[model samples]
Target: MDSIPKKLYHIHRFDSRSGLELYLSGKEDMVFGEDFLKFPMMNLHYVFSRGFICGNLLIDFSIGAFIHHLYSASNIFQDMIIMKFNEKCSMEVRRWHGDRTGAFSWTHTKTSVEELEGKSDETQDKELNLKASIKHIVTCNLEEENLAHPLVLPLADCVISAVLLDVISKDEEDYMRNLEKASNLLKIGGHLILFGLLNTTYMTAGADRFHMMKYDESFVRSALSKLGFVIDYCAVQRRRNVSDLVDYSHVIFIAAHKEK
Candidate 1:
C-alpha cells in the first residue's frame, strides 16, 4: 500500500452510551495530543449495541444482532475501517445474522481457515480495495485470543484491539498474551489502536469481577514501544455522566505504527 491519507477503522459499536458514538458523531469536543492526527474517513464495525436490555437476553441477543444491523446499515466498500473479533464460530454466526437482517449476504464456513478467509475478504472488499487501491488500514479487537487468529494478523494494515474489562490487570498472563498477539498481528510499519478503562470496578452477568487497567498515555506508549510499535497518537478522555452504571472512566485511544 502506498502512503496515502490515513484511513481509520473503528472497532467499536454505535450506541449512545459508548464513547465511540460521540467521537464519530463529532459530539465529543476533545482533541488528540499535539503529535496525533485523524484518519480521512472513519468506518465502524459494531459488535454490540445498547438498544437491547442488559440482562441475559441482552447479552445473548446483542452479540449477533448488533453486527447484523451494522452490516446492513453500513457501506462495506468505504475507505476507512473498524472491526470487532470474537472466536471463529461467533464471528461466523454474526455474519449469518447480518445476512438475515437486511440487504447483506452471509456465507457460513465450517472451518477456521474458511471463516478467517471469508470475513477478511468481505471486509477488504468494503474498505481496502474500494478504489482499486490499497490504503492505510487500522483494526481494533476486544478479545485477546482473537488477535492471534490467522485471519486477523495479515489482513489489517494496522491492528488496534484489547482484552476484556478484567483480563488486562487481573490476569497478567492473559494481558501479556494479548500484547504478544497485537505485536505479531501488525506488519512492520503498520499501526495499532488501543482502548481501555482506568481505575474502575464492575460486574458482568456471569458474576465476573471486572477491574480496569490503570493506564495513562505514557504507560500505553511504553508498552507498545517495547513490542516494536511507535506511538503516533495518544488521547485520553473522560466518559460522560449517564444513567447506565457501566463505568467508562478514563477512555484512551492510541495510534501506533510498527517499526521496520
Candidate 2:
C-alpha cells in the first residue's frame, strides 16, 4: 500500500496582516516572537551606520511595514521611496507615516536604534525625523512587464531589499528575474543592499506558512556578480532565534555596487 505524503506548510498564500501583527510589528513575546526583528535589526544598523556611497534618494523594498532600518539611513539620505507590493500595505505605511490611529507602534524599534547609536536620553524626535524624510510610498507589482510603470519611478542611488526575494521568488528563475527588476530601478554605479535569510524554505506568518526560496550565500554572490555588481561587504550571521516562525539558518547581509 502507498503511504500518505506529508502535507506541505508552504502551500498557503502569504497572509500579510498576520505577518504584520506577529513578527514585523516589533511586538516581542516568548514563543517564535522577535526573531524576525533580532536578525536584521542590528545588522541593518551596522550596514547603514557607515560606508557605501552616500546618496539623496534611497529606495526601500523591505519586508512588511518596517521602518526601523531607516533610522540609521536617515542620517545619510535626504529622501526615501518605499515600494509596497499591495495597496493595503501601502495604506498601512501611509497610516504610520501620518501618525494615524491603529498604526503599529515602532517606538521600541526606534529606541533600539537610538541605543545602537549610543544615545541615552531621547524623545519622539528621532521617530519624527524619520517620518519627515519619507518622501513617497509607492505600490509595485512584480508580474507587470514594466515593474515601475504608471508611477514616476526614477532610478535610485541605492536600493535596499530585506528578505523580499526569498519571500516572492518561486524558484531560481523567478529569483533572477525579480533581481533584475530591482537592478533596473537602480542607477548605474548605484549600490544594491540585500538582506537574505539563507536556507529558508518557508516562513510561518501567524499559523499560516509562506514559501521562501531556499538559497545560500554563494548563490547570492553569483547572482549579483551576474548583474555586474562589485561586492563590497558581505556579512553572515548565524541564526539567533530558534523557532517555527521561519526555518532559516543564517542571515546574510550584502552591499554591492552595480559596475556595469
Candidate 3:
C-alpha cells in the first residue's frame, strides 16, 4: 500500500529522523501530537505542508487566510466572531483573532462560562451582530447524527463539521443522513466544510476506545456533492513527524459551498 505513492514514501522517509519527524509518522498512523505547547510549530508545519509560508510566528495564519478569503468575496468589515464548538485549550483561534479586537464565543464540554469569560475581556473589544460578519464557523462535532442543537446550520453563514461516518455508524446511509442535517443548517448559498480520518481508527486526545469510519477523498467529495455542496477546495494534510513516543498518520480537509 505504501509503495503506490512516491510522495508518501518520501514523507515517511523524512519523518523517520527527528522528534518532529516521528510525530508526522505517528499522525499517518492515527496519533495527534501530544504536546499542545508545540501547537504553534505544528500549525506552522501544517500551513507549510499546505504550500504556504514558513515562519516562527504565533499569529493565527489560518484565520488570516480564511478572513482574506472572506474579504475577497464581500465587503463586510466588522470584526469576525467565531463560535467555536468543542475546542480544547488550543490557541489557534485566539492567535487568529490577535489584538485587532473582536468577539469570540467558545463552547466546550469541559469548561464553564466563567472560565471562558476570563479570556473574553481581551477579545470582546466591540460587538458586531455575530450572524452578520462571520463568514464561517469550523466545528469538530463528530457525533453519530446531526442533532437538534442551537449551533446547527440555521445559525451561521457557514459551518465546518468533522464526522467519522464509517467508524461511528458503519453505514453509508448514516453518513449521508448526518451530512444532510449539516447541509440544512446553511442558507441557500452558505458553505459546509467536512473533514475525516481516511482509513484510520476513531481515536483522539489520547483516547483509543472508539470506532472510526474510513474514507478516501473521492468518497467524501461525492457524498458532499450528493448533498448539494459544490467542491471549492480539497487537500490532504500530511501528518507531521513529532516524536518517536507515538505514531500516527494524515487526514483530509474538504471545503464545499452550497449553490444558489
Per-prediction tally of clashes: 8, 0, 26
The parts of candidate 1 lying over 4 Å away from their true place are 1-97, 101-155, 162-174, 203-212
lDDT of 3 by residue, 61-138 (tens): 121112222221112223233433223212334433452343232221012212323434532322222224554444
Candidate structures ordered by TM-score, highest first: 2, 1, 3
lDDT per residue for candidate 1 within 1-260, as digits (tens), equals 12222111113222211222222222334232111112211111221121110111001111111222123123322322333332332443333333434322222111221232355546634321322221222233445466433444333454435324222343444455656665665556655555555444431211122333444556566677677777655556565444223344555555566775
lDDT of 3: 0.39
Order of candidates by lDDT, top first? Answer: 2, 3, 1
Question: RMSD in angstroms, candidate 3?
Answer: 13.6
The number of residue pairs in model 1 that clash at the backbone is 8
Off by over 4 Å in 3: 1-146, 149-155, 163-168, 204-208, 242-249
> For model 1, which pairs clash?
9-81, 9-82, 10-82, 76-126, 77-126, 139-160, 140-160, 141-161
Residue 112 accuracy (lDDT) in model 1:
22
Selected candidate, larger lDDT, 1 vs 2: 2
The most accurate candidate by TM-score is: 2
**Weakest ten-residue segment in model 3 by summed lDDT:** 56-65
- Lowest-scoring 10 consecutive residues by lDDT in candidate 2? 1-10
Q: What's the distance in Å from true for residue 155, model 2?
A: 0.9
Candidate 2 per-residue lDDT, tens place, 61-163, comes to 8766777667777777889899877566678789889989988777666556656877746546777878888899987777775665678677888898988
lDDT of every predicted structure (CA atoms): 0.36, 0.75, 0.39
